[model samples]
Target: MNQKAPEVHPSSEWVQRIFDRISGRYDLLNDCLSLGIHRLWKRAAIRALGPVQGKHILDAATGTGDLAIRLAKVGAQVTGVDFSGNMLIRARSRAPASLGVQFVQADVLKLPFKDHHFDSTVVSFGVRNFEDPKRGIEELWRVTRPGGRLVILEFGGWMSFKGFTQWMARSARLLGADPEAYAHLIESSCSFPSGVGFVRRFLENLAEVKTQSSRKIFFGVAHLYVLNK
Candidate 1:
């Protein structure tokens, strides 16, 4: 018996709706699905950013504000942005007032901000969600000031990808998660470029695009790349 594979949405609107529907359980699912290792991965990405005392940072696609909160703690003025309103609401509600982490609803493909506005930009497990990843990376560098850093943490795509991301969706489904949402998720990750290939594309329109550091985590399931603009 042959079963049809699940379909992933092509529209960004469908993606937003999926995130909104699962925004409440997003954080818990992160802890459960990744077995809390995501926190460690995120920390490693921040560490790659080096010192951040008084630096202005942007956390793109910052769902629930986990990475944004961490960036704020390191003395960086952080602005976390996402297009999903429900995700922003959760990020705002969970973020401590004293942290002063600003949560805004915005699309990554076309950010609404002046050029070179941030000292550095960080996206943790988020860049893959952008409808246009190359544009999103360019936009990240656009807001980043000269000598600024861009740190991206995402799932690696150069490995055996068949059924892996789909298997992830199945696991999440067993826990009462949205299979349709994760089917899209798996599809996106499989389609997203990472590490070296992504670096070449990310540096296409930038000057002095330098990689400060690179790391592979969990046996190359994820990668951390820090670029200087």
Candidate 2:
């Protein structure tokens, strides 16, 4: 919710540029599109982190550093890693001065850090964009300390709300999102890892896993996964 503005959706090559274009307009669009309920979803994701003081936190795919800032606010020493240079630039420019947060431009598939380096890791609405989510999940697990936590926030499918799906699609289209984009949103969620599937994936690699999902303001889907290494 506190993430910096977003850019117009763009291809992988234009990742940085796309985020930059939407950076200034990002926050407003999010609130407008989701009716300000994203704040609650973010809060829920952060809550799953429990207490974080003095812990080292990694905010992977930290677009605009919103989760990093939130982690810092809770007394964690936060490091934000992202692939988009412009996104990092905007994060650096807008982040709170005294939060003790650092930003790094790095690929999630190959994080430039030692194994088991962080106490906790987080990614909000960032995994869907990964070229290889399994590799991305592995990278998160790799950098995380044993017994540490990894929390991810992403979209959930609309299957549970079939009656309202059409209305929701129309609503998104009216809110400045391209119809194709909204359709892609629906399709991606349909194929994305479900709550149980995600837990199964975690069971294969992580120590303990817990999950919770919600609909944000009748406009967006939010899924939170907490994995302890």
Candidate 3:
């Protein structure tokens, strides 16, 4: 029997509610589901930023501010934005004031920032949640300064590994995540483009944008894409 698929792009309000609901356990669940490999992937994404010290950077969809906190600790003036107020609360609590990281409640699609305002911008595992990913990417590009890079770390296509989405859903449930929230995550990842497909479909048409590199992480469970403007 064929089963119905989960919604790949849920409403913005739904996205906000799910993230807020899971905000408390979000980081832990990520550790459990990815077996802590996500930490390594994040480190790789940071390295691709290429000397962020003292640079102004934007960490869009910075849930819990993990990447933003890391960037700030490394001397970059970082601003992390997310639409979930609960998530922002946790992010603010987790981030030390001395780190110079600020958490804001804002939408990625409609960032409250001026054009060419950031030295660099990054989105880790957040693009898929955007109702319009291409527009999201364009927004990220809009804020990045000329000659700066846009770094994105996202899941690879799930088709290569049969039953991977099922495993993720089951594991997330076991790890105490809301079932529907994780279902949205699984469905979005399964539907979103990655690596070359992402570059070709979403990024190639952007003016003055150059694909720096696209590499798979951990046997294609995730991918890192770096683009220079």
TM-score of every candidate: 0.89, 0.76, 0.93
* Residue pairs with backbone overlap in model 3: none
Task: TM-score for candidate 3, please give it.
Answer: 0.93
Cα deviation of 8 in candidate 1 (Å)? 8.5
lDDT of 2 by residue, 1-229 (tens): 2233223223444444445555555565557655787678778878887788999989998887877887788898999998887778878887888997999988888899999999988888777666667678888888988778888877665433665566556666666654444454455555566566755653355434443333332344667777766
Model 1 over residues 32-121: C-alpha lDDT tens digits?
767898988998988888788799899999988999999898898999999899999999998889999988898888899899999999
lDDT of 3 by residue, 1-229 (tens): 3233346666677789889989999999888877898899999999999999999999999999999998998999999999999999999999999998977799898999999999999999999898788899999999999999999999998533657766777788778777677767777777788888988887888877765789998888889999999
Best prediction by lDDT: 3
On TM-score, the leading prediction is 3
Candidate 3 lowest-lDDT run of ten:
1-10
How many Å off is the CA of 203 in candidate 1? 3.3
Instruction: Arrange candidates by lDDT, descending.
Output: 3, 1, 2
C-alpha RMSD values across all candidates: 3.2, 6.1, 2.6
Residue 28 lDDT, candidate 3, scale 0-100:
93
* lDDT agreement of model 2 with the native: 0.70
